[model samples]
Target: MTDLLIRPAHHHDHDAIWSILEPILRAGEAYALPRDWDRERALAYWFAPAHHVFVAEDAGAVRGSYTIRANQLGPGDHVANGAYATHSEARGRGIARAMGLHSFETARSLGFAAMQFNLVVATNSHAVALWTSLGLREIGRLPGVFRHPRYGPVDALVMHRSL
Candidate 1:
């Protein structure tokens, strides 16, 4: 794999970041986002005020991106939640794993005591396996919750790890 740099996303990186996010959102398989989400709205969601976004770059090209934010409001604020997306051409390159690790450290630095992935699409075995390997365990399962575009009503897992 090439040298990958994980850094805080800048305002100018919007286009490159969107290139990685667009396909993932449109796929409607991994995330619970709208399939027909437009670019403007999608960008707004990814860069929402509550999220701290980051990107993985290789040779100055954005390869992946992620967002870190509080999992809930008020009393549940100590736990962090994150979402990741890798560019189609950059899969299998360990970009997601690197981003996950970085996100954990970032979460800790931001005063988060734990990290929770509230909606890990069950059919996304790669991600499930990755999170498991990273020491996150399935804490809960929502049966037939995710209406996966291809897999129909599939389960969604809640994976969590104490920081």
Candidate 2:
């Protein structure tokens, strides 16, 4: 594994961040995002004012990105939610794992009591295994909830772990 530097994303990282996110969004395999979403809207959603965005840089290139925010409003705000994306070429290099660990620590520092992934596409087996290995348990499952591009409607799991 390379020395991955995880840091808060800045305005100048827009292009680099999008480079890592676009392919994943287009694939429509891991996330529930609209496949036809344009770059501007995608960037806006990922870098929204309320989100704490960060990027994993390896050898000066952004290999992955993730965003952390309150899972919901009011009473449910104590739980944090997050999304992650790694460049296709960066897979199997531990970028996602590094980012997940960073998000866990960041979430705790932000005062969240726990972290939850509202929708983890069941078809994304690698992510399921990774999150599980990281100590997040499958708290709930919404059967046939995600419309995967390749595989018809698939189940989505709600994973949670104390921060």
Candidate 3:
């Protein structure tokens, strides 16, 4: 990855962003999203105005992407929420960790007091471990909250951390 940079995503980056998002969405392994979600809907959901979307570029190509925004409205808004997706080819290269740390800093700068991942599928141990390593604690768990394409219904863990 030459000159990898994290920056606000532009309209033209949608294709690359979608390319990264589709596999994640289709897998329905780590996220709570529906596996049957179409590209158009996923695009709108990710690029909505209420969230801040970013892309990690290397050598002028998109390698990873993340979306950050308030977890809730009004009082709950002090806690931020984020979702990340990396190109399959870019895995195990520190892209996710770098994006996670970057999102933490970006959230704090926006005045958020903490960050919360509302629904991290328990079956995704790698993500659970990563979030834990990032200092997010598993505050709660929702049983049978996520429908994994292969694993059927699975528990979702709520991970939170003060920024």
How big is the positional error of residue 11 in model 3, measured in Å on the Cα after superposition? 0.2
Models sorted by TM-score, best on top: 1, 2, 3
Give the Cα-based TM-score of candidate 1 against the true structure.
0.98
Error of 2 at 11 (Å): 1.2
Best by lDDT: 1
Model 2 regions lying over 4 Å from their true place? none
Q: Could you tell which candidate, 1 or 2, scores higher by lDDT?
A: 1
Query: Lowest-scoring 10 consecutive residues by lDDT in candidate 1?
Result: 18-27
Order the candidate numbers by lDDT, best to worst.
1, 2, 3
Q: Put down candidate 3 lDDT per residue, 43-66, tens digits, no spaces.
A: 899998989999998778899999
RMSD of each: 0.7, 0.8, 1.1
Over the stretch 1-163, how does candidate 1's per-residue lDDT look in tens digits? 5889999999999999888888888889999989888889999999999999999999889999999999999999999999999999999989999999999999999999999999999999999999999989999999999998887999999999999
Candidate 3, pairs of clashing residues: none
TM-score per model over all chains: 0.98, 0.98, 0.95
Enumerate residue pairs that collide in model 2. none
- How far residue 62's Cα lies from its native spot in candidate 1, in Å, is 0.3
Clashing pairs in 1: none
lDDT of 2 at 19: 84
